[model samples]
Target: METVIITGGTGLVGTALTNQLLERGYKVIILTRQPEKGTNKAVSYARWDIEQQTLDISALQQADYIVHLAGANVGDKRWTTARKQEIIDSRTKSSELIFKALQTNPNKVKKVISASATGYYGITKDHPFTETDPPADDYLGTTSVAWEKSIAQVISLDKKLVIFRTGMVLSKDGGALKEFYKPLRFGFATILGSGDQYISWIHIQDLVRLYFNAIVNDRLEGIYNAVAPNPVTHKELVLAMAHAAKGRSYVTSYVPAFALKLALGEMSIEVLKSVNASSRKIQDTGFQFSYPTVQEAMEQLFK
Candidate 1:
């Protein structure tokens, strides 16, 4: 059986992707800072220290493929100077560790798949951004550029590489959806800013499937936007989500940009940013999205 080693395999995307890989009969090794014995026979955990820049070399030698998803949650905290550094370091450092391990070790790793964010396109854009667009000169863009660059070094090692620029991942379990669902319990459909900002999103299941597709489909190289076909405005998304949850019982309320800025500080820029990214490139590869629209995704998640 083919073996795939994943960094940050305990996160939402990683956990979902792990189940997918295991169900398909692939051996899964999760590289974690804290190694633990897994209950599943097909799953195991290895040690990787980003601080010391160390990795379990034995894991690298056994991996047929590598999926790099280790990174700090950018929205998890206020973006203080130190927090911003942590965000960049978490992604780039982990990537550096993976690349270094693969470089020094004699391994059979054929392809490497890494996750990047749609923030590479910048905070807001009117037109749909493609993979060819230049990385914006902002914090998010620069962070993504550096993170991808760290992983891109694997190409020099003659290993195939695939990088996915992901958008907002909507999952019923946790993530953006859970936060969106928060106000709904009290019958409030809280809309952020003007609520017209476009939200490029993909279902958690679909996102995991995209990773699986890259693993099996060799044609997928370079970068592709991991978003649903149809992007929705923030207002439309909240209304649909509210409809799914409480029919028409929820009250639609707008949260001013200033309020969000005050509450979130600098991180509010991302919460209010309108990023319309295209999935055309991935779709052209004959890859279909199981949940191509927000409405459909909401129905599935709420049903």
Candidate 2:
């Protein structure tokens, strides 16, 4: 069995991906800040501090693949000046650390798959974004652009590099969907701005499958939008969640743009803006989505 080294293995996506990899017979090693916390028999943990640039060199010795998912939570707090720096530094420094580790011990890993986000596109009106679409001009966009660029350094090592430009991931356990529904359970849902802003989302299961596909398929390189084929508006998504919860809930009113701006600052655009992403790149790579529509996905989660 091949060995895969994963960073941020305790996160929502990382936890799911680690289980899937282990189930499929891959030996998993996770780069964690707390090595003692990783008790799973299938997983071995290594300690690394990106800020200090310290890593256990042995961790990369037999890594067949490296899945980079380490980063500070974006929506966990308001994007203050320090918080913004934390987000950017966490991503860039972690990637740089990984790349440096690879450089120190060349040919240890076969491929490096790093995490990017749909925030790369920032706030767009209605233009459907593709891999070729230029990144938007916003704080999130700058953060994502810098995040991806930091990982691009690994390409010089001649290893296969795949970047997943993920969208809003819908899952019952955690992520934006659960938070979005928590408010609806009180019998009302608030739409941000016009609520017509398109939200490109992918089921957690599908996103993990995409990662596996990229790992096994050698042809999968460069960037791919990890989003559903049918993107829905903010209103449509909130309504679907309310329906799934079977709550007597309705979108009462729009949260004005100014209010969001005042509340979230630079992060407000992430919630108030729209970007319909095209998934043709991944589809053309021969990956079939298990859940294509928001209704089907929500049904599975809610049922």
Candidate 3:
């Protein structure tokens, strides 16, 4: 069995990915900042500090493949200049550390799969963003592009590098679905801004499987959008979530755009930006999405 070392394996997606990797009979190695998190017997762990540029080289020595997923959560805090830099560095610097480790250490690592975001295409209200679209000039666009470029450097060493420009991931345990489901129980969910922003999303199951596909499918290279084909507006998304969660509905009211701007600061724009993303490129690779529609995806989650 091949060994796969996943950076940021303690995160929500990483936690799930670690399990899926183990079930497939591959030896799992996780690089984490926290020691207690590496307690899983089925998975091995190494410690790394991206800012300090410290890492345990032994993990890379044994890794056959590496899935780069470590990054600061964009939604966790207000996007001040320092916070923005933190977000960018957390991703790019962590990746640089891995690349440096690979270059300096004797390793058998063959391939690298890194997680990116649909934000690369910026806030597209009309045009359906595809992998071929140029990276936007906005903060997210530039940050994401930088993130991808950092990981893409590994390709120069003749190793396979695959980047997934992921969209909003819908999962019951955590992520956007959990936040959307929270307000549904209170009679009405808070719809962001005008509630017209197009949310290109994917079921967590499909996203996980896509990662597995990237690992095994030698044909898949470059950036592929990890999203459901049927992207929906904010209104439709919240309503669908409300219906799924106990058949309740959002009180036909939206949180004002200005109020959101005031509350969330610059982050509000990101929350409300319409992103019409595409998953066709990934689909063309013969990997079918298990949840192709929002309704089917949400129903399964809420059921």
Candidate 4:
């Protein structure tokens, strides 16, 4: 059986992807700082330390493909100067560790697929940012540029690389979806900022399937934006969620941009930034989205 090595395998996206890979009959090896044994015979864990710059050599040799997902949560904490550095380092350094391992070790790994953010395109007003668009000059943009650059080195090792500049992923288990539901519990549909910023989002199922397709489809090389075809504004998204959760029996409240800035600090820039990214490139590959609209995605999740 072909083996796939995944970094950040315990995360929201990583956990879902692992289950999908196993369903496809692929042996899965997750690289973590603290490795442990799992009950599944096809699933195992290996050790990798970013600070030490080390990975299990045996695991690397066994990998037919490597999915890079290791990184700190951008929205989890206040973006302090130190925390911002940690956020950038977790992605760049972890990728560098993988590249170094592939460079110094003898591995037959064929392809390397990694996760990126729609922030790569920075803040776009109405125009849908495409794959060919230049990386933004802002914090998220520069950080994404550095993150991609670290993994781009693997291309020199003759490994095929595919990076997905993903947007907000809406999942039922956990993520922005859970947080969005919080206000609904109080019967308030809260809108952030002017509620005009566009939010590019994809359902968890489609996002995981995109990664799986990248692993199996050789035609999907280079960067592709992972988002739904029809982008919605922040207002449209929250209202839709409110409708999904409580029909039309909910109060609408707008959270001013100033309040968000005071609360989220530097991170609020991301929450308020309007990023209307396109998925046409990936769609051109003939991949169909199961949940193409916000209503469709919300219906399934809320059901």
TM-score against truth, every candidate: 0.97, 0.96, 0.97, 0.97
**Error of model 2, residue 93, in angstroms:** 0.5
For model 2, give the 10-residue run with minimal summed lDDT. Answer: 245-254
Candidate 1 per-residue lDDT, tens place, 190-279, comes to 999999999999999999999999999987898999999999999999898999878989899889999999999988988888899999
Better of 1 and 2 by TM-score: 1
Candidate 2 lDDT (Cα, 0 to 1) = 0.89
- lDDT per residue (tens digit) for residues 1-303 in model 3: 999999888888898899999999999989888856667988888888898998888878889999999999998899999999999999999999988888888888889999999988877756789899898898999999899988888988888999998999998888877877776767776788888899999998899998999889887788899999899999888888777776754465578999999999989888988999988888888888888988888799888
Instruction: Count clashing residue pairs in model 4.
Output: 0
Model 1 spans > 4 angstroms off: 37-42, 123-126
Which residue ranges in model 2 land beyond 4 Å of their true spot? 247-253
Point to the candidate with the largest lDDT: 4
Query: Which ten contiguous residues of candidate 4 have the minimum total lDDT?
Result: 34-43
Better of 1 and 2 by lDDT: 1
Q: Cα lDDT of all candidates, in order?
A: 0.91, 0.89, 0.88, 0.92
